[model samples]
Target chain A: MLTALELIGIAAFAASGALAAVRSRLDVFGVIVLALTTALGGGTIRDVLLDVTPPTALVTWPYLAVAGGTGLLVFLFHPTVAKLRRSVLVLDAVGLGLFVTGGTNTALALGAPPYAACLVGMTTGIGGGALRDVLLREIPLVLRREIYAVAALAGAVIVALGDHLGFPPEPVAVTGSVVIMGLRILALWRGWNAPTAPKLDGV
Target chain B: MLTALELIGIAAFAASGALAAVRSRLDVFGVIVLALTTALGGGTIRDVLLDVTPPTALVTWPYLAVAGGTGLLVFLFHPTVAKLRRSVLVLDAVGLGLFVTGGTNTALALGAPPYAACLVGMTTGIGGGALRDVLLREIPLVLRREIYAVAALAGAVIVALGDHLGFPPEPVAVTGSVVIMGLRILALWRGWNAPTAPKLDGV
Candidate 1:
């Protein structure tokens, strides 16, 4: 079940990445590169921070195959894929939730400190999209006026708290994931925006 | 001797980063962040790839101190630093040389394959600057028309070949660094550029 959820998340992220590349009018190779980065970049960073050699994403052929295949599909059918933007956004929220919870659990299992685990979890949830935006020469949405990182950080904190307080891992994971997804979806529905820095005349 | 050289490279990169931040009109905190990222981002990525946990930059107080101190200095003395841009660029070339050679040697020592080591070397030479540009919402110069990555790759190839041929490590490292620095400086002086993709009418 966990593997299935992970694969779904990877696919969703890959699709979103491909769609973004298509919108940017990148070539097929660029689309594939973006898709793979978006799908696997976060997990790779998380694994590196936790000292997991080779990164699970790199060793697991399924992750590469799924991300690459999704990229190709989107490149060939971009018109149809573009029409599914709403669905992709909803699926991306699901991906973010799964990544944050799973990353936190992994860090905790590896005996990382609570604060470090929370940070690792947040990095895992947001790193890929941040990388994608960076490669596209744009400020990352998480670092801009978006509630995305806040939601991920909140989920990470919950997971870390659960682990610290001796709660059941399974229920805590589920709750954390739900909270992230719920907050993200609600923010979207309500057109909520994170606050930006106030305008100043000079430094 | 090697430690002193490494510190010099770190300081040079940090200064370059801080100067860029000043040019962008970032506040003090932002300037410091950019300086650290520019100074240590490449080594951090290389360490992560080689499964070096916590990263050398994170564990070593000297690295952090040098970078942060350089940032503070640049922030307080922007006009003076701006006047020294030419010297900074030369020092940046030196840093690129040291990082590329050092990164390749580190990767080879860790039992990575030759091709992977070469790529890692190039990444180590260019990664920090790439991150700086990405954070600044600009396309990385290495990925644009700059001859930067090419010079790094050429140096890496030489280092890898020398290692495969059982050459003395110190001499080989010196040769590689000299080649990279020479090539970069020459490119700057001669106004050489890497080729860009041809404009296409349609996808």
Candidate 2:
């Protein structure tokens, strides 16, 4: 079940990355590169930080195949993909939720402290999109104006708390994921934005 | 000698990152964060890829101290630092050379293939700066039209070749570092630019 959800997340992120590449007018190769980066970049960073060498995504051929295939599909039919922006955004929220919960669990399994695990979970949830935006030469959307990181952090905290309170891992993970996805989707629908830093003069 | 050189490299990269953050008008905290990222990001990535657990930079307080100290110094005396742009550029080249050589040797020691070692070396040389540029919302200078990656790759290949032919490590490392630093400095002085892709129409 986890594997299936991970694959779906990878596909969603890949599509989003490919679309961004297309919008940037990148060639086919660039689109595929971005797709792979977006799908695998977060987990790769998380694994590395957790001292898991040869990151799981790199060793697992299925992840690569899924991400690359989705890139190609998006590139070949970008107009159709673009038309599904709303769906893609929804799917992206699902991906974020899964990544946050999974990342928190993975860190905990690796013996990371609760606070550190929460940070890692948040990083995993947002790392891919931040990387995609960076490569596209834009400020990361999460760093700019979104409830995105906050949503991820909230879910991560819940997962950490569940672990601390002796809750079953399975139900805890499900609840955490649901909360993240719901919050993200709600933020999108309601046009919610995170507050930006106030400007100061004469620094 | 290697440890001293690595410290110098870390300090140089930290200063460079801090300067960039100041130029971008980031706050003091931002300056420090960018400095730490630039000084350690490349080696951190390289270590993870090479499957080294608990990255050396994270474990060694000296690295953090040097990077953070440099950041604070730059933040406090940016004007003096900015006036030394030429010197900083030279120091940056030195850092790049050290990182490339160090990264390649580390990878090779870990039984990585020569080609992979070379790529990791180049990444170690350029990754920090790339992250800095991305955070500042600019295309990475290396990706744009610099001979930066080429110089690093050349140095790495030379080191790999030395290892393949069973040369003693010290002289080979020195020779590699000199070659990378020389190429980078010469490129800067001569305004050498890497070739860009030709324009293509209609995908």
Candidate 3:
């Protein structure tokens, strides 16, 4: 079940990356690179950090096929589908929730402590997006005023706390994911943001 | 001496990032972000992969200061500094050489295998710039034209081979660094570019 959600998230994220690449005026090659990175970059970092040999994505072809195929499809149909950008953002939110929860869950399964799992989850959720922004030369929305990673952190912490308190894994994950999605919507609606760059002062 | 050179390289790399940000027409904050990432992102990645506690630059004030401070200076002097953009490419090449050699030396010191160390060196040399390109939404030089990472790889391989043959560390490092710098310049001057983006029609 969780793996199913993760795959969905991957596809959504890849689509988002492809859309961004198109908006950035990239060629087909660039679109593919962006899609692959958005879909795989976070998990790749996590696996590399955990020393997961060969990486899960490299272990099979489906992951690559899904990300790449989805990206290509989106790239080809973007002009037709772009009007649905708002709907896509909602899908992006779902993916974000799943990714953050999945990341934290995977970390815990690997025997990381609650705090570490939560951190991993946060990284998982935002890592690919951050990489995407970096490639696009845009300020990462994570570091900017976006309530993006913060929401993931909050949800991960909740899920981790639930697990630590003996909650069943399934419930904890679902609860956490829901919390993340809800919070993201709230954040957007409320225009929540991190503190702006410290006011520049003449030293 | 190594520390001084590292600082200089960091400054130059940061300046290069800042200049790239200008070419992309980013705002002041964006410029600073690009500068810092260009100078320090690769090392940060290396530390994270190695699981080093605190990561060197974050632990040490000077390295952190150099990256960000250089960005600040470049941002303040954008107009004047932008005029030297062409010359900055020369400094960028020099910094790439220093970075690759430094990364290779550090990896070797950590007792990594020659092949892995060489890869580490190559990654460290190109990682920051690649990241900067990614952020700017430009095609990464590593993924596109320029013998950029190829130069680092060649230098890293040479140093590794020298080490295996019991060559003195200094000579190996010096020659290796020179090889990278020389190749980089030749590639830049002669328009050497790696193959990329094979046709998508078949697959």
Candidate 4:
């Protein structure tokens, strides 16, 4: 059941990446590469940081197939998919939640301290999109606007708190994921932004 | 010693990243983060792909110190250092050569196939700069201009061929490094670019 949720998140991210590639007017190879990076980049980072051998993304052939297939589909039918932008944003929030939960849990399982686990979790949530934006030659949305990374960090902190309090992992993970998705969706709906540095005068 | 050469490469890359950060006008924390990422990102990717546990960059505190100290120095003395752009470029080429050699040798030591080792080597050479560019919201130079990735790839292929021919690792690494630096410097002098995709009509 958990695996199913994770796979759904991966597929949603892959689809989002495909859409971004299409919007960027990239060729087929570029689309596929971007999709794979968006779907797998975060987990790859997490696994590497936590010293997980062979990184699950590389070992799991399904990830490549799914991401690549999604890219191909979007390349062929982007106009149709582009019409569902609202739905895609919602799905992306869900992916954010799922990845945050997974990353935090993985870090904790690997004996990372609470703060490190939270950071790793947030990184896992934002890493893929950042990589995608960078590849597309645009600023990362997480760094520029909205409450994205903040939401991920909040969710990760909750998981860390639960661990510190000796709560069961499953319930903690569920709560964290729900909170992350909810906060992100609410931010999207409300047009919220994290506080940026004040503009310097005459710089 | 090989270790000393690698340290010099790390310091050079860290300095370059610091200079970039200073130019971007990032905050102190951001400068440090970018510098460390630029110094360590490539090796981390290489290690992850090769399943090298607890990546050397993470385990080695000196890497962090060197990168962080460089960031601080550049933050304070950016104007002075910026005048040495030519020197920095030369140092960067040397760093690229060293990293490619080190990465290829590490992969071979870990029993990777020659082709895989070559890819890993090239990745290690370019990954740091790519990460730095991405964080700064620029397209990776490797993907767009010059013969940078090509030089690294050529060097990696040489390393791989040497492995296949049962050549000694030390001499192979030295040869690859020299070739990479020479090619890169020549490309810079000649103002060469990798063949770009032809301009599309009316798009």
Candidate 5:
């Protein structure tokens, strides 16, 4: 079931990436590459950072196949998918929430400290999107005005808190996922931005 | 000294990044961010993948200091630095060559195979620039028309082949570095690009 959620997450992100590539006016191959990167970039980094030889993607052909198949569809049906911005964004948020939960669970399972688990969870949720924006030569949404990663961080914090409170794993994960999704939706609808450090001398 | 060489490499990459930012019409903070990312991004990824605690820049105050100082200088001295595009590119090539050797050495030292070592080398050499391009929202130079990382891979292969032949590390690294730097210079002078796979008909 967790793997199924992850596959859904991957498919959503692939579509999101295909949208970004279309916006960037990339070719078919570039679009597929971008989609794959957006879908798998964060998890790959997490696996590598953990030194978990062969990374999850290498061991899981289904993940890539789903992402690639989505990309192929987006390429063939550009006009149809172009109007899917709202739905795609929502699905991407689901992926973000799902990944945050997965990452935090993995870290805590690995015996990391609460803070470190939260941090890794946050990273797993947003790292790939950050990579996507960086590769596209755009300001990372996470680093800038977006409240995206903050949602992940919040969910991760909840995971830590719930574990500390001795809550059951299912409740902890479901509650955290819902919270992340809610916050992300609020952020998207309200255009919420993290306050930036002001310029020098208050000028 | 290795320290001096590292600082020089940082400055060279920072200057190149600043130049690119200026060309793209970015602001002061943008300039600094790009400079630092281009200078330190590759090494950061390498360190993270190796799971080095606290990471390299966090470990050495000097690396961050050098990168930040170079960013400041490049931001403040844009006009003079802009005139050195050719010189900066040459230095960039040399710096990348050195990074390839360093990455290969580090990976091999960590007991990785030649294939993994070569990958680490190529990633370290080109990863920073690729990260920079992604942040700038452009197609990465590595993904675009450039023989950049190919040069790094060739150099790494030289190191691996030489090591396999029972040569010492120092001589092997030096030979590989020189080879990468020379090939890069030749490629740049000749405006060479790696051949892309041909596109399919009506797809």
Candidate 6:
């Protein structure tokens, strides 16, 4: 079940990347590269930080295959894929939840301090999309004005805190994932945004 | 002597990052973040890839101190720092050489394959600036037309090849550094650029 969820998250991230690349009018190769980066970049960074050699994303052929296949699918039918905006958003939420929980759990397992684990977990949820935005020459949405990172951080802290209190892993993971997804969905539905720096007149 | 060179490289990279942040009109925190990222981002990524636990950039207080101090300096006197364009470029080249050589040697010491070492070495030279540009919402120059990555790759390949041939480490490192810096300076002087993809007049 966990494996299935992970695969779904990876596919969703890959699709998101492909759509962005298509919107940017990148070539097919660029599409694939973006998809792979979005799907795997976060986990790779997390693994690197945790001192996991040969990151699972790098050594796992199946992960690459899934991302690649999703990219190809989107490339072939971008018009149709683009039409599924609502579904895409939902999938993105799922990915955010999965990555946050997974990243936090992994960091904890690796004996990272609670603070480091929370920061790393939040990054793992947002880093891939942030990187994609960077490649596409846009401000990362998470940094600009989204409840994204806040939601991820909340989820990560929940897991970290629960683990600290000696709670069972399964319930904490589920609750954390649900919280992130719920918050993300709620923010989207309400058109909510994190506050940006106030404008200083005549600056 | 080597330690001094490394510190100089760190300071130079930090200064470059700070200048860019100033140009981008980032506030104080953004300036500091960019400075730290540009000074140490490459090495951090390289270390991660090599499975070096607790990235040196994160663990070594002095590295952060040097980068932070340079950022503060640039923030206070950006006008003067900006005027030293030639000096800055030279410093950048020096940093590039040191990072490329350092990254390759470390990867080799960790028993990474020669090809991976070469790529990692080149990336260590360019990653920081590329990341800074990405944060600033600009396409990385190395990916566009700059001869930057080419020079780094050349230097890396030289080091990796020499190592493979059982050459002395000190000489190989010195030779690689000189070659990269020389190529970069020459390229700048000649206004040379790596070829861009041929224009599709009616895409």
Best-matching candidate per DockQ? 6
Off by over 4 Å in 6: A27-30, A51-53, A58-62, A134-139, A186-203, B1-36, B58-127, B137-203
Candidate 5: where are CA atoms >4 Å away?
A4-15, A26-94, A110-120, A134-203, B1-11, B18-41, B52-84, B111-120, B130-203
* Evaluation by DockQ, superior candidate among 5 and 6: 6
The sequence of per-residue lDDT tens digits that candidate 4 reaches over residues A32-106 is 888889989999888878888688988998877877787788778888888777677888888999999889988
Chain B TM-score, one value per candidate, order as shown: 0.92, 0.92, 0.87, 0.91, 0.89, 0.92
CAPRI-style docking class of model 5 based on DockQ? incorrect
Better of 3 and 5 by TM-score: 5
Report how closely model 3 matches the true complex, as a DockQ value.
0.10
| DockQ agreement of candidate 6 with the native complex | 0.22
In candidate 2 the C-alpha lDDT for residue A31 amounts to 99
lDDT of each: 0.84, 0.84, 0.76, 0.80, 0.76, 0.82
Model 3: CA > 4 A from native: A191-203, B1-44, B47-109, B113-203
Give per-residue CA lDDT, model 1, range B69-185, as digits (tens).
999899999899888876788788889999999999999999999999999998898999988888887667788735798889989999999999999878898899889889888
| Cα lDDT tens digits for candidate 2, A17-65 | 9999999999999999999999999998888788777899899999999
Candidate 2 ranges beyond 4 A from true positions? A1-44, A48-105, A111-122, A141-203, B144-146, B191-203
Ranking of candidates on DockQ, top first:
6, 2, 1, 4, 5, 3
lDDT of 3 at A118: 72
Write one digit per residue (lDDT tens) for candidate 1, span A1-203: 77788898899899988888887889999999999999999999988887988799999999999999999999999889877876788888889999999999998898777765776797798889878888776655564434686689789999999999999988898889889989888977665343534342100
Model 2 alpha-carbon miss at residue B114, Å: 2.9
- For each candidate, give its TM-score against the true structure: 0.59, 0.60, 0.56, 0.61, 0.60, 0.60
lDDT of 2: 0.84
DockQ of each: 0.20, 0.20, 0.10, 0.18, 0.16, 0.22
State residue B138's C-alpha deviation in candidate 3, in Å.
12
Task: Between candidates 3 and 6, name the one with more favorable TM-score.
Answer: 6
